[model samples]
Target chain A: MTGMVAAFTATILAAGSTTLLLAVASLVVATILGMGAAFAKLSGNRLLRTIASAYTFVVRGIPDLVVMLLIYYSLPALLNQWIDAMGIDARVEFPPIVAGIATLGLIFGAYMTETFKTALQNIPKGQIEAAIAYGLTRRRMFVCIILPQLIRLALPGFTNNWLVLAKATALVSLIGLQDVMFRAKGAAEATGMPFTFYLIAAGFYLFVTVFSLILLALLARRFEIGLRELAP
Target chain B: MNWDVIAENLPLYAEGAKLTLLLAVVSLALSFVLAVPLAFLRNGRVPAVRYAVLGYTLVFRGTPLLVQLFLVYFGLAQFELIRASVFWPWLSSPMVCVLLTFVLNTTAYSTEIFAGGLRHIPVGEIEAARAYGMSRRAQAFRILIPGMLTRSLPLYGNEMIMMLHATALASTVTLLETTGVARRITLNYYIQFEPYVTAAAIYLTLTFVLVSGFQLIQRRWAGYLESRIG
Candidate 1:
């Protein structure tokens, strides 16, 4: 029992931080891609709309596990071959973090696109029109008129996507990323207490998820300040 | 771009597609059966049991299904008690392990979906059923179950497609479902995108069919539910 406890502690020490790092990095990357996709979907150009829609449809249909494996194992070989043909003797290999982040970012990007698009549509059109008629620059209009409401409206769906994405970082282990899940597996093998170690990993994940929900709720409250009942 | 490569491996892909369907359909059926009773038990007057089931659903929802699968497949075997039990032999099989994980995971998600549908059941309907001199069992059989299933069909359909996506995780447990076969074909052929892309195409077609089927259900039933609730 003591051995299992010590092994779990060591496993958490070794890989827990990496797991958090992966989730945060991928979440940022995914949010950017999602914003881009959302804009492309809403843009006037037919080709952009078609491309964005197709990207989302493709991503949503396939599982993230397949996408992650493809990016990790196959993409490097494909890239390296091209690099070799360019008179470079060097090979290209993505570190597990890079591959995990990029694959997860791509997968979650589809979900966030829908969240963003729905949020954008819910903004009262009179508000955007008023901002435009007041002669604000595009940047100014976005910052001053649109951004605040967007954040408020997007928070609920964003919270859901963020929770799901954070849990997904666990899958990075399958691609040889030494995240908490990976370390826990090693601990299970070494200590012969697979349940003990796996339980520890699940605890860490549940903690991250619960913590995120609390933080998101606070953020939603902050963004929802004016519209809520402050009956004082 | 390599149509020839996919054409050569069509049989392998077809085999994979079959397993994927089997895994998803069987598990989903079991989840539906498990979820209906759990949905009722979820709100049963016993706070202790209710909280226990809620905890079960919460754990499943709060963590990744991959971890849950690993916990069952690899973690449980470490226990001497499990190894000595009759259940050990059942859990020893990979396909059984995968099916159990999917069934448990889908049951949790579907329980929430069905519970939501149950919440939408108007009180007056239950009273009407009671006033009509119907027994509790008859009321449940004649009205509540049908009403809940009908109302939750759209959400349940989404859950079913999610289950389809989840069959990809079976590959991690060594089941050669669609995504698993794709990985093999990719590594063997030294082509990354071709096999995975083909798998994605198959998955997309399945999802399209699922969505259309649900849309038909929604059109038939949404008007009925909206009038009852709205």
Candidate 2:
């Protein structure tokens, strides 16, 4: 018990921090990439539309676990070769943390791209025309009229993607990151009580996800205030 | 890029792919079979069943699949009762435990999807059926189930693909599926890119095939429903 307790703080810090860091970085990156992809998807250019469509279709079809594995194991080797060709003696090392974040961001960005694209198309065309008629510049129209509405409309799907992405950080342990699952595995093996340690780990995950869900709900409610007339 | 190494291991990789496909298809079938009844029970007037499904879905959806697989395989082995029971034979096999966990987990998720589909069915249709002298069982089987299945197909297809990717986790429990084989090969050769890429290609191909099959199923089911209505 003392041994488990001794490891508990370190385990929590490593797992919690890594997981939270990955989620925050991925969310930011995913949103930006998603917006780009959304624009590409909605663009008049056939090549841009096809590029975005292909990305969403392929990423959505493939399992995220495969993406994580490929990025973690294969990416560094490919990078190292590139570095060697560039006359750098140092190995182009990709740490597990960076790999996890980048791969997850890439995978989930494909999902969010679709969500944001839907939200973008959902906006009334008349509103954009009205903004244009008012002599609003493209940037001003996007800032004042489009982006806010897109964020509000995309919030629910974005929240869902966030929760899934958080849960997916567990897979990083497979590539040798000492996250919660890694520590839990160690404690379980040492104590010979797999159930107890795993249950604790699972509880922590549930807590994080449930807490995030509550925060998302609050955000949704706050957004709803301006549109309360539609509320019953 | 080592053609010789890949050629030497080609048969082994093929076997791994076979195991992955088997695990996915079997688990998907079992989950779908189990989910329909569970969905029915949850919607029925039974508090015990409803709460049971609620708790089941919460635990399954909330926890990571890796932990769930670990708990079922390793955690249960710690129990003398589980070891001593007649069910021990089935639980002893890693594949069985993986299949069991996958089925139970997917069933919980799909039941929610199924219930949502059920809720979307027009109450007027059921009422009209009753007025036309349709029995409850007949109404449910003929009208409710088919209607729910139609609406639920697309979401269920997504779940199926998710399950395909999920089978990769079975390697954790000593199952030598595709990812499992890739891990072992990577450990041996210390050259990661080739093996991981191979596994990823296999998974990507499977995903493509599964999506296309789902599209066909959707079209076929839609036509069947249309013919019935006509």
In lDDT terms, which candidate is top?
A: 1
Distance from true position, residue B75, model 1, in Å?
1.5
Cα deviation in Å at residue B100, candidate 1?
0.7
Q: In candidate 2, what are the lDDT values of residues A109-213, reduced to their tens digit?
A: 998998899999998899899999999999999999998888889998899889888888888888777778777887778778777777778887888888988
> Which pairs of residues collide in candidate 1?
none
Q: So what's the TM-score on candidate 1?
A: 0.91
Runs in model 2 lying further than 4 Å from the true structure: A2-10, A83-88, A226-228, B223-230
- Model 1 DockQ (Cα-based): 0.67
TM-score of the second chain, cand. 1:
0.94
lDDT for each residue of candidate 2 in B46-128, tens digit (9 for 90 to 100): 89889988788877888788888888888887788889999999988999999988888788789888887888788998898
How far does residue A186 in candidate 1 sit from its true spot (Å)?
1.0
Candidate 1 CAPRI classification by DockQ: medium
Candidate models: Cα lDDT each: 0.88, 0.84
Show where candidate 1 strays beyond 4 Å.
Answer: A84-88, A133-137, A230-232, B1-5, B122-135, B138-143, B187-193, B223-230
